[model samples]
Target: MDVRLLEKEGFAGLFMRLRAEGLADKPLLAALEQTPRTLFVSAAHADAAYQDRLLPIDCGGFAESADLVARLLSLLSLEPGQRFLDVGTGSGFLAAVAARMVERVVTVDRYKTLVQLAQQRFAHLGIGNVIARQADGLKGMSGEGAFDRIIATCAFDSMPRAFVEQLASGGVMLAPILAEDGRARMARLTKIGSRFEREDLFEVPYRPFIPGLAAAL
Candidate 1:
């Protein structure tokens, strides 16, 4: 798909809608404008890349919509020179976006193929600040230590302690937490010294958070 056409006909409307809903800002919109969603998905889905919906990707994973990603990034309050951790990297879309806003991004996925694809995507985009790895996201990347911001693209029954521990003081994390009523709610956690304050952002549907590393390609 042509980049100009995608921006003019697709992303422009999406951004306008996000602005109307108070889910977008100047920096976030600029980052989304710079990153083409088409480059992150397979060619078959390229036409739908800019649409405000999730697109299925490899390993039964789904690329989140631009709106959701924008909202998550806005909530994270990312700043330049901050470190970021992206769980369930999927197509590396979120990581790529975060990399543009932060100094470094460490993105983890359980599927090897997904990680490989994410790495390739990062390279193709000339994104040097993102480190894509294949590992159990539930375990988190301890080696990376604390991060200024963390975001999970998948839904989990509960927030993992590892993720909480990896957040630097005053850091923020956004994830989809499954509630007792069988609904997933977008939750935000902020690490304040030794305590983590939780806030429910909104209700949204997302793929379940799978634990452990995948054995298959």
Candidate 2:
């Protein structure tokens, strides 16, 4: 078999497991298959890109694992033509997937280097619908206005008010909520009128949400 085809099959098998585990559905799997995970990680970690695990990227952050990302996407209930907001862009893997599934994606990250790298990756993939920016994700992207779906890759002690306020009516937001015991639970919030209905999806492990922009790249 050709080397590239073999590698593609390996990644496909991982997505198959994700589907069997109920972490991904047909649309999500198709999107994952389309986006090359290796493009979103450092070249040194390219060999492990197909594994269902997080890989370190620029700055001190790590790219989220495929399973975790799939779970988040599943929670969003994304639809075509919807605008998506991705907080904590990291390596921009999630944002890239969102761009493929939705009409547009506005992703924000605290690290300038990650933002730049993500933009380059989006360009290389011919993904024009994704807008990458460097910002304090906890504050939310007020300038972009409301979004149909909002997803934060980091864990916060409590849901940020800005995220809640920026969600469009009937929109959904998913993030990991941290607790005093050092445990994090995946929470999904749906905006109904002016009120938000919250539901705990499951437990997850994620990096702490940092406030403000990073001082250095």
Candidate 3:
């Protein structure tokens, strides 16, 4: 419908320009174009959908920053046929994008309303590969290790041991880890053998992990 706000303030156009300049993947650019951010945000803030900034959605928390999402995806260098786990599905924007590039996307969030909205969005968009569920993310998913990629949108005080155990060899996980003082930082962890190596990327701010999420772990 009305993408005027996105045209005026949303950096989608700039992202496309970057894609054209070869800074980003062409397919990702296409997915961004295909998904309407306006639909993910509340009606009051719908005009802010296209902006680079995060906008408040149905929950008390806001959506992830577009720049952060794009940057994370770029760092992951996703490949088709990979199994992906998204710790916080949020408005399902990232999962929707991943659905286009990955064979399967398993995303979870603690909030039932958020999951329901995401599911509705997925249905509306005709996305079939992504499975969105309402579950605690901190406890780690009980699935076969060997996931090609794992992403966490919520801030974690410590790297979840379960997540590390579930990562496939050479799998990469993008997460926001909190410092002892509660400051948030983004890092990329890659599993090698029985250990995982971490590379600090930059500072970030994200909502704390869901309450029961960490308790279940």
Q: Which pairs in model 2 have colliding backbones?
A: none
List the candidate 2 regions with Cα displacement exceeding 4 Å: 1-3
Ranking by lDDT: 1, 2, 3
Question: Between the candidate structures 2 and 3, which one is better when assessed by TM-score?
Answer: 2
Name the runs in model 3 displaced over 4 angstroms: 4-12, 16-22, 213-217
Q: How does each model score on TM-score?
A: 0.94, 0.93, 0.88
Clashes of 1: 0
Model 2, range 27-139, lDDT digits (tens) per residue? Answer: 88788888888788776877777777778888988887877787789778888999999998988889988888999999999999999999999999999999999898887
* Candidate 1 vs candidate 3, lDDT winner: 1
Looking at candidate 3, what is the lDDT of residue 211? 57
- Please give the TM-score that candidate 3 achieves against the real structure: 0.88
Q: Going through the candidates in order, what is the number of backbone clashes in each?
A: 0, 0, 2
The top-ranked prediction according to TM-score is: 1
